[model samples]
Target: MADGRVDFSTPKGGSGASRAVFAHFTLRLDPDRLTRLRSPLAEIFDELAEEGPSASDDVMDVTLFTMLYGLRAGTES
Candidate 1:
């Protein structure tokens, strides 16, 4: 999405013509995982803040929002 180059390998017969398709699949998978990771992290962050000392919320929110919103663009970006 950021106009960057990625290197990935696939099955020989399914390789060349599938570069764009496979890259799209792999990129989509990472965001799904990231969104999953962020959900629990946000919950833990909220609990920690409620209990005692905690990290900065603004930083965390911005990071998570950026990631989630960025994923909406998909590989076409």
Candidate 2:
């Protein structure tokens, strides 16, 4: 496990549901790889940040799944 923290915050009005939702996570990786991973991760999180309250649950699910799939695929290459 690499030693570091990555944080993500939603924009003031971007959260989808009326109820509260929270996500906190830690990723362990080589320090040298952190810089390479940050940009793509940020891009994924940025998409989530732009999702409006009107977005359907299915859409959100797919978006999240796609992010994970892409990351896995990238790492396998």
Candidate 3:
């Protein structure tokens, strides 16, 4: 099986807020499955933003998830 690694950061800011906040995360998963999940993940994230407190600008929303690093390997290193 092929493995893929994703390292990303999510920007955090509430509407009209000037301060910048960011959260970083790294995830390892099957590449093929990750590819298949792209669309669905996007939809789910969007839905969460739209249906949660973020919709009212009362909470910080992850406006962007920037991938900073990635690696793939046949075995864990």
**Per-candidate local distance difference test:** 0.50, 0.50, 0.57
Cand. 1 Cα-lDDT:
0.50
Stretches of candidate 1 above 4 Å error? 1-29, 53-77
Candidate closer to the true structure by TM-score (higher is better), 1 or 3? 1
Location of the lowest summed lDDT over 10 successive residues in candidate 3: 1-10
Error of 1 at 49 (Å): 0.3
TM-score, per-candidate, Cα-based: 0.30, 0.30, 0.29
Could you tell me which 10 consecutive residues in candidate 1 have the lowest summed lDDT?
Answer: 58-67
Q: Write the residue-wise lDDT of candidate 2 on 1-77 in tens digits.
A: 15422223344476644333445565667655776777788876788679645556533322243222223324544
* Tens digits of lDDT, candidate 3, 1-77: 03522223343553554454466777786777677757676787788768866446444434555553347567957
The list of candidate 2 runs beyond 4 A from truth reads 1-32, 57-77
Clashes of 3: 0
Candidate 2 vs candidate 3, TM-score winner: 2
Error of 2 at 10 (Å): 26
